[model samples]
Structures are given as C-alpha cells and as structure tokens.
Target chain A: MELICPAGTPAALRSAIEAGADAVYCGFNDETNARNFPGLNFSRDELRKGIAFAHDRGARILVAINTFPRASATALWQRAVDDAVEAGADALIVADIGLMDYVARRHPNQRLHVSVQAAAANPDVIAFYVETFRARRVVLPRVLSVVEIAEIIRETTCETEVFVFGGLCVMAEGRCSLSSYATGKSPNMQGVCSPASHVAYEETAQGTTSRLGGFTINRFAPQEAAGYPTLCKGRFSTALGDGYIFEDPVSLDATTLLRGLQSAGVAALKIEGRQRGRAYIESVVRHFRRALDTLEDGSEADIVSLKPFTEGQASTLGAYRKTWR
Target chain B: MSHSSVASRPLPTIPPLLTLAIRPLPLLPLQLVLGGFLQRILRRNPGLLDRLGEHRYARFGIKPVDLPFAFIVEAAPPRLLVVRELPQGLDARVSTSLANLLALVEGRVDGDALMFSRQLGIEGNMEAVLALRNAIDDAGLDLPGELASLFGPLGEPARRSFELARDRLTGPPEEER
Candidate 1:
C-alpha cells in the first residue's frame, strides 16, 4: 500500500519525501483546502517547485482543492484546478460534485480522487463517483470499520485510501455543521473549522478556559494538558458528566491494523495533518514508512514508539475497532 | 443557518492578560541566562536561522509570563538581547512560563498542545509566528544537549544536571525520550 502523507509547505513536502512518504498531499494557501490555517499551505509557485522536487525524487504530489466552491465563486475553484493541473499535480482530490463534473469535462485526462469530505461510505456512492467523475480513488470517511471497508473495496471499482494516523473527526465528513453553528465558518464553505479568529482563551482563578465564538468549549486545570478547542472534541456539561460528550481528545493510530487494511486491498494509507510543521511530518512519515517496511517483510511493527507523537498524548484505533457505534 | 451556508460571524473577544495580578520579582538574572543560552544555541546551529529564510529578519519578543523581563531575538543576524521592557512592535511575541519555554526548547513537551491549551500565548503576526515555530521545531531541538556542549569535556555531567533539573521542574514520567 502507498503511504501518503500531508504537507502544508514546500519545506514540509521536501521533509516528507526525504522521510519516505510515497506521496505527499497538499493544498494551495487559500480557502480551496480544508486546512485553511493562517500562515500554512503552499503558494502556486511553491506548489510548482514542490511537485518538481517530489517527482524528481520518485514521489507523487496530490493537490487538494477539497472545499465546496460557492455558487457565485465557482470560477475561483476552477482556476485552482487549472493551476494545480498546470503545476503538474499527480492527481486532484475534490469533494464537490459540480467541480468533479467540471474536471471530468474540462480535464478529462486528470486523475481525480474523491475527497473524504464527500463522505462516501457505501459501494454505491463510491461507484457513483467512479462512474461520473472517473474518480480513480476515494478517501474513505472515518466512520467505517475494517469489515465494512473491506466490503466497500470488494463492491467498488475505485481504489481506497484510509486515514491511519492523526486527528479523528467525530462527525461524518462533509456532513457536520457544529463548527459552522458555533463559529459561522463551515469547513465545507470556508475550509476552516473552529477558526482561530473565533477562539479565545482566558487564564482565570478556576483554570485556563478556552472558548470558541463566545461559547465555552473546555477548561483545563493548571497541571492538566489542554487540547485545541475543536468543537467536536470539546468537553461539555451533560446530564451524565462534564466531560467529552462527543469524542475524547485523542488521535488515531492504526499501525497495528496495517496488515488487515492491506489484506482488505487498501491502495493507500493517509496521515492527516497538513497544518503540522516539518518536524512532525518527518517523524510520523518515517515511523509509518518503517512500519510498512516491517509489514512487507512479514514482521509485526512495534507502534509503542509512536505514543510520544500522538495528539493529547493519547491514541485510539478509532472506527477500525468501532465499539462507539 | 445550516452547515452548508456561510455567514459573517462575530470575531471572538480575547481577554487581556492581567499583568497586574503578577507579583513583581527579580528576573534579570534569569533573562540574562536565557538570552545568553539562546545566543549560543543560534550560533551553534546557523541552520535554524537559515530555515527561516527572509523571515529570519523578523523580530521576536520572548516574554516568560512568570519573569519580569523579556528577551528579543533576531534570527537574521541571530542575536539575543535581554530587554527590561517589550518593544512597541514585534513580528511575534510568545508568553509562557520559564520552565515551559525551556521544555519547548528541549522538545520535552508538545508545542501544539501547549498552544491549544492556552498555556503558551502568541500575539502579533501569525505568519511570522508559524515560520518561527517551524524553524525551531525543524532544528532537532534539545536545549540541555546543546547547552552541555558549551562545557567541552564537562558536557556529560552538564547534560545530566540539566536533565535532572528539567525532570524536577516538569514533574511527569515521560513515556518516550
């Protein structure tokens, strides 16, 4: 299976390549990509340079223009597609059907990958994207178990990519509006979830309180580690308890299940953190590459070393071992 | 409004840091030591400055919230100087505890988690701060290791002492080195 990694900048792309990423996925520095964090992502010239650098070193670059284009601003996304194509992106990962259709009609030869934001869980939805947009691959959403994923792979013609490591979204991709309701900026429209501009923190006598758009998300004691105030991972007061009501502040680590995913005919394993720095990209990619090597040699990979790198210093198998559902 | 729709949301109101609540204490000795340490570290690893490229010229003010003084860092020419007061304008200003800052420099703690939890506060230009962070993180940072090297033949003992000090300060059983 191909080990795909995330890169937010040219420097990070280079780091990922050197660290043994088979392919590095990134996006232009704008709302066209979901990780629209301030000061992260690539410029067009940087993308061109990054693609050349990666391709020269026997690696591929996938451009993610994954955010939904506004009805009045379709031209901007179209231009991004055109620019990415011109920049020699190996493939374009897209979520919007209209944009996919545009790619099919205009750049028919361009290899399209369905973005996870599309949330195509079953074979029928995957087949639809494959048939209509000729999507060569579909990045499966984070809601399916290994058996379900295997079934989908068996039933669909498109290649399958699954996120093996990094942040886990509690909601179905492309469907959740909790962030939009709280901050008025949806990942689908603005490519930002729990935007920093809509976040505030106050060190009070009680604790360090984090709030998003005037609503409290989580509070941390002086000794406790605090996570990002992502709406989905926020601790809330419920009838049950004032704890993580949706999901805990944990990351996904599927290193142990790599063999199962490979047996299920998974084409790619993706690490999701384009907003991370080069150090993070390099370390994670190196570990995953080593694990893949060991797996190829029929050896079990020791994933305990990866504990230090996990978000919130915790890891879960996530939906792959789904008891949550 | 639904998930698909976009609307103009009001910007979040950031509560100002209450410097008045902090008891004024002597911190010049700590600031000088930190400033000297930073200068030595930057000198030894010029690559850290190079990684920032043009952004190296951008000025950063490092303010340890627990300390009374701040230090200004210029990565371009790579200079660190202790300041009695913060400059009027800076590309980025990071405010945190002295121990936390040391922990970050040593790569003993997760920088992202600290930022997320609001333990480390950043003010000023976002791009400069991001660039600075990437550069620092990319350098294979180890404050104790780097500082011990300055001691020549006494490096090993110095490193051990620094590690012990850090352990006492941070006070957590780390799972990974």
Candidate 2:
C-alpha cells in the first residue's frame, strides 16, 4: 500500500519525503484547501518547487483543490486547478462536481482522485465518480468500518484510500456547517473550520477558558493541558453531565490495522495533518513507514507507542473498529 | 485575511522574563542535564542535525519566560546550550511560558495562535526562527519517550512508570472516540 502524507509548507513536504513518504498531499495558500490556517499551505512557486523536490526523491505530490467553489468566485478555483497542473502535480484531489466536470473536460489525461470532502461513503457514489470524472481513486470517509471499507472496495473499480492517522472529526466529512453557524465561514466554501481568527483564550475566574466565536468551547484547569477549541471536541452541559457530547479530544492512529487494511485492498493510507508542522510530519510519517515495512516483512510493531503524540495523549481506532456505534 | 493583516503590522515589545513566577537556583542543574540530553539526542538522530543545519540560528535565544533562564541554540553540532541572559547581536529570540513552549514541542499547541496572542513572542529574524521551528518539529520530541530513552534498557519500565504517575496526578483522560 502507498503511504500518503500531508505537508502544509515546503519545509514540511521535504520532511515528509525525507521520512519515507511515498506521496505528499498539499494545497495552495488560498481557500481552495481544507487546512487554510495562517502561514500554512504553498504558494504557486513553492508548490512548483515542492513537486520538483518530491519527484526528485521518487515520491508523488497531490494537490487538494477540495473546497466547494462559489458560483460567483468560480474563477479562483478554476485558476487553482490550472496552476496545480502547470506545477506538474502528480494528481489532483477534488470534491466539487462542477470542478470535476471542468477538470475532466479540460485536462482529460490528468489523474483525478475524489476527495473525502465529497462524503461518498457507498460504492455506487464511488463508481459514479470513477465513471463520470474518470477518478482513479476515492478517499473513503472516516465513518466506515474495515469490513464496510472492504465491501465498498470489492464493489467498486475505483481505488480506495483511507485516513489511518491524525485528527478525528466527529462530523461527516465535507458536509459540516457547525463552524459556519458559529463563524460564518464553512470549511467547504472557506476551507477553514473553527477558524483561528474567531478563537480566543482567556484566563477566567473559572479557569483558562477557550472560546470559539465568543461561545465557550472548553475550560482547562491550572495543570490541565488545553487543546484547540474545535466545536466537535468541545465540552457541553447536558442532562448526562458536562462532557464532550460530540467527541473528545482524541486522535486517530491505525498502525496496528495495517495488515487488515492491506487485506481490505486499500490502495493508500493517508495521514491527515496538512496544518501540522515538520516535526509532526517527520515523526508520524517515519513511524507509519516503519510499521508498514514491518507488515510487509511479517513482523510486529507496537502502535501504542504513538499515544504520546496523540491529541490529549489519547488515540482510538475510530470508526475502523465499528465498536463505537 | 485577518491573520495576514495581523502579521503585516509591527510587533509589540514583550515583557521581560518573569523571575518571581519561577525560582532561579534549580535552573542550573536542569540546564546542564537538558544540554547533555539534547547532545545525545542529536548524536543519535543525525537527520535532525542535517535538517537543522539548513538554517543559520547562531546566537538565537529560546526564552521560556516563566523559567529563570533561556536556551541559546547553536545551529551546528552540540546544538543546544543554556545561557544566563540573551546575548547581544543575536539573530532571533523565541519567548514563551514554559508550559506553552513544552506544548509547542509536544505538537499540542498551535504556533500561530501563540504568536498572534503574544503568548509566544518572536523578534529579530523571523526567517531564522521559522527554520528553527521546522527543524525542531521534525525531531518529534515526545516527553515520555525522550525521558525513557535516557534509561537505555530500562526505557519501557521507566516510561510506563512515568505514564502511570502522570495518570495518577492528572486524573483520567478524555474518553476515546
């Protein structure tokens, strides 16, 4: 299986490749990508250079122009597609149907991979993308079990990729609007969820309170380590108790399931941290590469050792185990 | 746009290290130990040096403002050295509370948030500081693993003990998804 990695900057792209990534995925510095954090992503020139660097090392580069384009501002998204192609990107990960149609009609020979932002969980939709857009791969959503993923892969001709590590979003990919309800910028349209500009932290009488768009998301005690106040990870007061109702601050780590995933016909394993820095990319990618190597060699490697790098120092198999529901 | 606008403006002067918040006596031993530990780490992980050597951070200072002293990181071999005060003619300075700095090292804190809030302040050459941050991040410094690596063969037991003590001290973690 191919090991796909995330790189928010040129330096991170280099780190990912040096650490043994088979392919590195990134986005433009604009709102065309999901991880549009400040000072993150690549400029056109940087993307060009990054692609060259990765190609020189026998690794591929995928450009994620996954955001849904506004009807009025369609030109920006179109121009991004053009620029990514011009920069010699190995593949384009796209979500919007309009953009897919455009790419299919204009760049017929370019490799297209359906982004998880499309939320196409079933084989029928995956087949639709493959037939209509000639998409070579479909990135499976995080809501499926390994059995379900295997079922879908068996039914569809399109190759399948699964997210095996990094942050866990409780909501269905690409369809979430919670951040827009709070900050008026949707991840699909603006490429930022729970944007940092709307987030603020204050030392309150209760404790250190983290607020997103003036709404209290979480409060940490004096010794507690605080996490980024994403709406999904926020603590809420309900009849049960004051706790994380949507999801807790936990990361997804699926290193132990490499053999099962390979058996399931997973074409690629993706690490989701386009906003993460070099150290994160280096460590996580190197570890996964080693684990995958071990799997290929019929050896065992402990995935539990990765817990320290997890969010809140906790990790889960996530929906891959199918025990949550 | 707002974030970029904030970056375009002139930065403010951050307050000096808060001495009253932390004691001065224990810092010497901690610095010496950390210096030795870092040297060993760099020696074992030569890729870290290869990546860090891409930047020139000679005389750059890392001031955990809540702590009593600062760290002067030399870009060449034997990368980290402790200093009493930030010397003159330095290229850049990264000043943050010890907790926040640790969080940054552990990949838990967002550097942009810390910088925008001035909780983590940076002055002088931003390029050099940016390169330094990238290099350090690629090293993937995990607290328990790092401490465990110090004990060699007893690493697993030491790591488990440290984690158990930490769990006892901090209470149960958030529920797994």
Candidate 3:
C-alpha cells in the first residue's frame, strides 16, 4: 500500500514530501478543510506553491475540500473547489454530498476521495460515495476492525486507506457531535474538535487536572503521562460514576498490522498528525516507509522503533485487535 | 482571542511558584488549560490576535509580521498589531477586553460554555494558525495570578482527587533548587 500523510500547512506538506510520504493531504485555512483549528492549513497561493513543490519532487498533493457547504454560504465552498482546480490539486477529498456534487459536475477531471469525517462505515455508504461522486478512494473510519476492512474491500472496487499511526477516534467518524456538545463548535461544522479554545489546565495543591471549557476532563499526577486534551478520551465523572465513558488517552498504532492491511487490499496507509512538527513528520514518514518496504519481503517489521513518533509517546493497534475490554 | 496571542509579553520567566500553587487547586494539566485561555483571549481581543502581524514581540523572539492582513490587540496597553504577509486584507485590532481571557487562564471558565458559544474569530487563512501556534509555543507564557475562582464549594468535591494528585506527584517545585 502507498503512504498517505497529512500536511496541515505548506511547511508540513514540504516536510512530508521530503520525509518520504507517497502523497500528502492538506486543507485550506477555512471551513472547507476538516482540521479547521486556528493555526493549521494553507491559503490559496500557498496551496499553489505547495502543489508545485510536491510535483517538482515527484510527489502528490491531495487537497481536502472536505467540509459540508452551508446553504447560506454555498458560494464560498464553490470558490474553494474552483481555487483548488485552478491550483492544480492532485485530488479533492470531500464528504458532503452537495459539495461533492458541485465538484464532480464542475471539475469532472479532479480526483475525488471520501473524507473519513463522513463516517461512511458500511460498504453501502462507501460504495454510495464512489458511485455518486466517482470517488477514487475512501478513507475508512477508525471504528472498523481489520476483518471488517477486508470485507469492505471485497465488496467494493474503491481504493481504501486506513489510519496506520496517529490519533484514534473511538466513535464513528463524521457522526460525532461531542465537540459540539461541549463547545458550540464541532468538527462537522466548525472544523474543530475539543477545540483548543475550550481547553484549560489548572495547577493547585494536589495535582494537575485538565479541563475543557470548565469541565474536568482528566486529572493526573506529576509522574503520569499527559496527552493533549481531546475531550472524548478524557477521564471524567457523571451521575453514572467516574470513568473514560468515551475512551482512554491512548493513540492508535497500527504498525504491527501493516502486512495485514496491505494484504486486505488497502492501497495506502495514512499517518494523522498535521498539527505536529516537521521533526515528528519526518520520523513517522521515514519509519512507515521503511516498515512497508520490509513487508514487501514478507518479514516482520521493527514496528516498536516508531514509538517516539507516537502521540503522547504511546501507540496501540486500536480496534484492529479488539484488545480493549 | 488568546491573551498571549495578542499580548506583547517577554520570554518565559515562570517562577515555578505558580505551577506549585496550581497543584492543590484542583486544576488540569497545562496543555488543556491553555486552550480555554487562548479561546477567552480571542473572545475579548476579537481580531487582536491576528494583529500580531503589524506588531512584533521582540522580547519573545518572534518575527515581525508584515502580512497583508493586519490584526490588532486590545491588550493591556492597547497596541495595533499586524499579521503581515497573509493574503487576506482583513485588518483587526485587539478589542482591549480581557475579562474572559484572564478568566480562562485563571481556570474559572467551563469547557462546555466555550464550544457552545460564538466567541472566536476565523478572519484569515486557518493554516497561519500553526505558525501562530509555533510562535505561542515558543513564547514564554507566564500565566498571571488571577486564580480567585478556584476556591469555595465547587472546590470541595475534588479534595480526594487533589490528594491523589499531590501524593502521586514527585519532584520539587519547578523553580526551587
């Protein structure tokens, strides 16, 4: 399988390209892109430059115009698609049916992929995007197991990609409204999740507890590891008692499952940290590239070596093995 | 909208005392706390955070922003900062209102309230946010001592939680020798 990577900005794009990513996906710094946090993404001109940068290096750039267009502001999204085509984007990753309709009709030449945020878990939905938008690929949600992924692959001809090393979402992608529930903003509409704006950390006499908005998400002692404040995974209390009702603070690591993913007919493996630095990108891209190479020879990869690159210095095979109780 | 996003503060000079005092207060880690602070700052300052392009924090080792779009910071001293080089022609100055920003950094605000409201801005390229983030992470954030909201009844339920945190933690205060 090829390696698909995330480039939150032009710098990240170049970093990924230089680090050995077969292809890099990024979004404009607007609602059009799904990772719509404050300090991530590129502008139109930057996209042009980024595309040229990738092409010049024999790499590919996939522009993510994935957000659903609002009825009141359809023109803005239309302009984004226009700009992407004008900039010579290699592919357009989209989720909304309306936006996909616009792109497929307006720029039939543009390659289209389904954004995982759409949460199209079943073959019927995945095939729906492929048939409806002529999507060439579909980024599968994290909820599916390896067996499930193989089943989907068997049922469709669409090229499939799975998140190999990076953050993991326990909930179905695109279907989550947790961030919106916590902060009026959500990944679907606002392009932010557990938005940085709502996160808080306080230090007092006892220990450190991470809070999102005013809600206590997780509390940890000084010696314990700390992860970024993704609200869904936070440890908390409710009328039902205290637990990570959503998830724990563990990242998804599919390094050990690379051979299986490739055999299951996945066309690409993705690493998901556009918010990370170049150093992190370079290390992850290089390690995965090497692992995939090792698999070409049917040998077990040194998957443990990529530990430092994992978010929070930890990683797991996630649902691939169903180890969680 | 974060204070430091627009505030012209110097390099880090955390006294270690601040972090130590935070332990017993039933607070979260700094990573989680910083987001609410940044959001609150954005709300009060409005476009001031984008104004960093026009104004440079020389003390913080940041480059002087000369972006086409300029943002202002209605900070403590009221400065006109610019977010130079961006293609957007949006010009914003800091709103000079910071009750919310200060409150967030102080751990007085709630997470649910932040998402459920319209308090931040997205006037320019979102990609620049990362560079802006780099600047923030690079900046030496010395959180102000506006932590009055941490006491009282809401503070009682977490006493055991606090004890667990305190007992489990090791090492002396960050600043103490």
User: Top DockQ: which candidate number?
Assistant: 1
Listed models, DockQ each: 0.11, 0.06, 0.05
The number of the candidate with the highest TM-score is: 1
The lowest-lDDT stretch of 10 consecutive residues in candidate 2 chain B is B1-10
lDDT agreement with native, every candidate: 0.78, 0.76, 0.62
> Residue A234 error for model 3, in Å?
1.5
Could you tell me the lDDT of residue A14 within candidate 3?
A: 72
**TM-score-superior candidate, 2 or 3:** 2
* Tens-digit per-residue lDDT, A181-278, candidate 1: 99899888789888866776666788777788889999878756567678888899888878888888888999889999999999999998887665
> Residue A65 error for model 2, in Å?
0.4
How far out, in Å, is residue A294 in model 3?
A: 1.2
Task: Write down the worst ten-residue block by lDDT for model 3 chain A.
Answer: A303-312
> Clashing residue pairs, candidate 1?
none
C-alpha lDDT of residue B4 in model 2? 8
Chain B TM-score for candidate 3: 0.24
- lDDT of residue B140 for candidate 1: 53
How does chain B of model 1 score on TM-score?
A: 0.72
Ranking by lDDT: 1, 2, 3
Ranking 2 against 3 by DockQ, winner: 2
Rank by TM-score, highest first.
1, 2, 3
Candidate 1 at A202: error in angstroms? Answer: 1.6
Tens digits of per-residue lDDT for model 2 on B37-154? 7776676655455444445435678887655678987756565767768887777778876655655664444464354233555655544555556555545566667768887999
Which scores greater on TM-score, model 1 or model 2? Answer: 1
